[model samples]
Target: MNEPEAGAAPEEASTGAASAPSGLSRRGLLGLAIGGGVAGLAVGAGAGLTGGVAIGRARAAEDAHSAYEFFGAHQAGITTPVQDHLHFASFDMMPRTDREDLISLLQDWSYAASRMVQGLEVSATGAVGGPAEAPPDDTGEALGLPAAGLTLTFGFGPGLFENEDGDRYGIAAQRPAGLERLPAFLGDDLDPQTSHGDLCIQACADDPQVAVHAIRNLSRIAFGRARLRWSQLGFGKTSRTTAAQATPRNLFGFKDGTANILADDTEALADHVWVSSNDEPAWLAGGSYLVARKIAMLIETWDRVRLSEQDNIIGRDKGEGAPLSGGDEFTAPVFDSTAIDANSHVSLAHPDQNDGIRILRRGYNYVDGNNALGRLDAGLFFLSYQRDPAQFISLQRRLSTDLMNEYIRHVGSGIWAVPAGAEPGSFVGEALFA
Candidate 1:
């Protein structure tokens, strides 16, 4: 649910071997062992090197298409054009863990995430080059897959700062004043199991397996330090961060995010999305706040409504996604026009009505099979990044009166202070630890 510039030195799988271990990179060895035949067993010897060269060759080709740098001013996924799929996960630090445990966890995650984004495996040993007796550092699912425009964004939840036991990581004072659990909203039937966590990672990629692989391996890397609380898989991106991409649809079959803040809009981004240096908590400068809402759509009930009524509820023509007041999809809505309902979704969430507030949205549609009543348990996984949590709080409160409220329920919720991106050799959130 973010944006990042595309550029990473594609780590090519090596085609030759017989080099000193100190001189060769992990990928180089993996490339030689898997790309070339026998006699090139510099590492992981007798660990089965007959897997074939297709995977190595595939990695090279995939890198050429999508490989975003993991280090920047802000995390990539937020401004990086929203990918086709999402694998969002939340985690909790294990009890009895000290500050070092937390720091090391972030370090491990950053190291693995940086490599994965470059179309490389989680470690030098990777899936096939590890010792025969030990588990490989990376899961094999994504070995042959390209980066697929994958971007992994990490965030620290309120619990990470201070939980019931108090200041577990000794950084409670650094928590932003607005970083607490989101207050209950109207029509909220949130489930605690999926509501909050101590940490969260948003992995996005065009390929579902690649996205899943990232979370899977990162979770494995956590081991005793932290445990995953909950996760969600999503597809059919509900919003666009770049104008080059088309606005995608939610499960409700209407165009979404027609007027979302674009990555190139630096002025708007600074004003609405990224946290500033002058803001509180100097450690979080250049970072942003992420609010995740797992909204459940009443699919069966909405389907029974007449087509025109559906348009009225959303305040946009389902066909062209234009405001009912006229003009194309991108045209400003004429809220004064009688054609637009005062309580319509568009009218209530419009920036003009909300004191000029705007948020960068990166949402996705999810269908998690049928519920007990034989209805599709599908809806929108709403993800938005704003400079302040109050921005979302205000908007959600205003939406309580929207016409679309009858068709959706907020089922899962979480808020995390997404720190600025890591520098080339540093882990994400390093400033916070410092």
Candidate 2:
């Protein structure tokens, strides 16, 4: 899609921004009126949240801009309401890139992200004509469009710190012990190129174009500082982060996130999600660890599985999504070994079996067309947030022998330290540098 160009104007002239839901705000139009001006009104959520949620301003027209706040105690995307689309990118620093360059790029990214989330261009000059020799600041495809409730969450991978030789960015001392390389597990087929990066950006929005535009502009801004390693475009979010949003289905047709951690669950968030101040690194007090896995689903094989077998493997009703042993969808599972398969997917991965450990999952379904083998290339792009990496590791270990593994393959994976959100003048991950 063409990026928003500065000269482009909206199709209709509308005034006044419609208020969004609590913890979400309505963003007004971005047209000829403010073509080259910075959005003095930065993006923000209506209700103050631990992790920010960008609320989009409802335009006078049908469902135009829904803005989510970008500044808060924690980054927005992790615990925010799940958007319809995801454009996740991992980046590697240039061989010669140093600490100072990394810091500069981060600052630039923060400013640009803050502006874009408000439905403004990356800079005051944006895509409009500037010095004839210089390219437009923003690509411009998103011009004249509302923010679409965009949220960009940033994270630093384990590689960002000490390398084989030693600390590369001179901040290895600050690396949290909880942030480390994820160990390989059973039935793993991780691709080296797609598995790891020094940094990552997760941009999500109700509009695909808006999400894509954010990543494109950020990559442009990074220029020689950091280059994209791998990115996946995901559609159909498989989880819910707020009570107001319904649980979404994954590509496998299962209702996912039925047991997810909602934003309103302050107790759960503190216990299982947010990193506490006493965790040694005072800078990471409100932060969380992000785990990403690119899972490949064998749709053909799954389609061939009998409905009874499918339900047996999943331990849930195919249509109603209720536990095989249960009453309603959200009713606590009985974990009855006689009624459900002992090796069922849910049975093994349930918190009951994993020392009562749970992770806040924010997964999305992905379809990347067909692979070389002429099979459908698609699966759940699993994303989860947790206070400690041990939670995820324990769950995966319990699922090593899950009946569902026959139809799914774990292909790519990475773990990153998602630091606390920035104040107005600060950039994401600025604490480490300080």
Candidate 3:
């Protein structure tokens, strides 16, 4: 659920006329390394998102492998068990590429994604078989590793439908009314370099290597059609989507998402998370909207605050994670209690305070080294999904005065209209192309 923004480049499909010989098997899996094993690439500037750690030819993407199906009514990651790691890449499409190029890229991307999610190589020819002197078809780093429950999701930003230059992909007419650019919010300190993207791919898996491998291969297949804009690697989920999973803590060390919407709540999903065919543009039937915010935490300052004040700002107990007014973690907070501050996080973000509106939060904890001042450069990479973008917008507007704002700043933001999953015979954005 955590993410970054990016653009792309691609590798041509293999001819299938060639197959790897014995001894070349696992080395072929190393073919999956991000940036195709290149260094100081993929993300730009401050992020330095390059580290193509090669997984030697001795390993294969098969050892403890377990896979999730690629074809479904809705994408898998949205409701799937929250994964351990996320490799999010955002991309800006190539200039004047036209609709055909976009379509072809989607076709190719879907093919590669479908195969990779199933623990198969991206190309029919695998990594070792290709033009002898040219680059290998597959990168090979993911070789010998289990599939690790990997899921890949695709999304289109407002720019993808119509950029400043007009509808470059000839997709302006099909843009859903709900896909507008997000409005600037209070306390926003967004960095343009890591902010929005024309498109995005979110890869999640239990294994970090498997997650990075997914994004790397897809970015490789996207060459010529797109370029990387920004990317983010996130760990330690800050939210839970199921009852079986224990509630996890954020950097603030509070049990987060204790009252979140569970994945199995079909009623709640239909009412708030998924978009139905009757909604708009018609093409987004089973899809949803994704909002990403890179919130930077002022941890040093937060740590300096008294423990009781910290709990007061959060509206929950430091150890129990219970609402300040009483009860257990999942117990409803007594919002009306005199002990509860009106501006506290839970008080302001509560569904009751927002007209029963709620968004599915899938945030992750991130630590990107240290800032120039040498303090922790980290915060919550906030990710949420809702049927209507306004649902999130309205709720956020209500939280504009939250007491937690003193310790966090929104440094990155993006909103993407997640297209529904590809059916067996189609690509991810097939409906839009139609």
Candidate 4:
């Protein structure tokens, strides 16, 4: 995707500027229009309009852009409407950094993240305003972009509390009992390079570029304090968060998250998503646990299987995504029905079969081109949030018996303690330090 040249002017510019090139991207043109000064809008000679007026107009135009608030009781991305694109990255704190370094990093991240979520630059001296001798404060690719409903959710991995160095941050005593490296599962062919980290950020937006831009700039902001461990780009969201969103399909083409916990279900969220005040770690009261699994699908092999067999494995019809027990997508499955296999994916994952356990899923499909074997390296990057990590552990343990396991391999995995949203002047995870 090529960006518009900075010097070009949009067709709508009334400054009598020449038209932009035919190839000017829609995003580039919008940027020029919204930026106010980008297209060289010369104020009339007789009118004594100050540059501040121009900047104010630009700020007002920014109000029309789509955005989400960064400060709240809970992070925006977790239960916020699932976006179409994702740029999820994990990071490790730099060696020898102290608690002050960690605190400063969080503060800096929150400040920049707050601005970016509003369609503003990461800093007051953003993309082009910094001293010419210094690098730009922002990467500038999203210069003309709207927020595109961008959301950045941060989390702490077990390592952030205690690692080989042992209680490096002095917050080890506050670590949630359930916040640890997940145990090895039945079919996990785990890759060490992609799993685990001291910190993680889940960036999501409607536009792929917007999502990428958030992570890229934040990674830059972490220059000395932290380093990115691994990242994944995903599209075609595999789950829905609200009732209005239609169920989405995974790489297997089966509608996923049909029975997922919705954002508006307060009781369900309280019981299964948000951490209660009485929970062991008081600091994580309103937060949740995030579990990420990179499941690789054997596309060629699955495609070769008969349609009926595929449906049987999933316990739902591939076409309508209705249970084989004869109901619509949302109908409760009759697990005992002869048509539904007890070991089927749906049956094994349903709450009825697992003591009413549920997780809010916000996942996406990813295609990382091809593997060395010439086979497509494509699969589902599974993301789920729960009040307790044990919820996921037990569910996953039950899934070991899933018939669909034959076609999928869990290649990468991670778990993080997603802190509650930052207050107006505080950074995320401030409660722990306080």
Q: Residue 224 in candidate 4 has what lDDT?
A: 62
Whose lDDT is greatest here? 1
Q: How many angstroms is residue 245 displaced in model 3 relative to the true structure, after the best TM-score fit?
A: 0.8
Show where candidate 3 strays beyond 4 Å: 1-64
CA lDDT of each prediction against the hidden true structure = 0.77, 0.73, 0.74, 0.77
Tell me how far the alpha carbon of residue 347 in candidate 4 is from the true structure, in angstroms, after superposition: 0.8
In the range 213-258, model 1's lDDT, one tens digit per residue, is: 7888777777666777888877778888777888887777888988
Candidate 2 lDDT tens digits, 209-320: 6877888777777766677888877767888777777767777787876777777777778878888888858878888898999998999999999999988988888788
Can you write out model 3's per-residue Cα lDDT over 209-268, one digit (the tens) per residue? 777777877777666667778888877778877777788899988888777777777777
Error of 3 at 413 (Å): 0.4
lDDT of 3 at 395: 73
Better of 3 and 4 by TM-score: 3
Preferred candidate (TM-score higher): 1 or 4: 1
Worst window of 10 by summed lDDT in candidate 4 = 1-10
Estimate TM-scores for all models.
0.87, 0.86, 0.87, 0.85
Backbone Cα, N, C clashes tallied per candidate: 8, 21, 35, 1
Ranking by lDDT: 1, 4, 3, 2
Tens digit of per-residue lDDT, candidate 4, span 1-434: 00000010001101111111122123222322233221111112111123222432354443325577787788889878787778889989989888987887787778777877877777666889867876666779889877777789999999999888888899999989999899998999999888989999999877666777788877776766677888887777888887788888888888888887777777888888889899979999989999999899999999999999999999999999899999898777888779999989888888888888888888888887677899888898899888999989989999888998899999998999998878777788899899
Segments of candidate 2 deviating more than 4 angstroms: 1-63
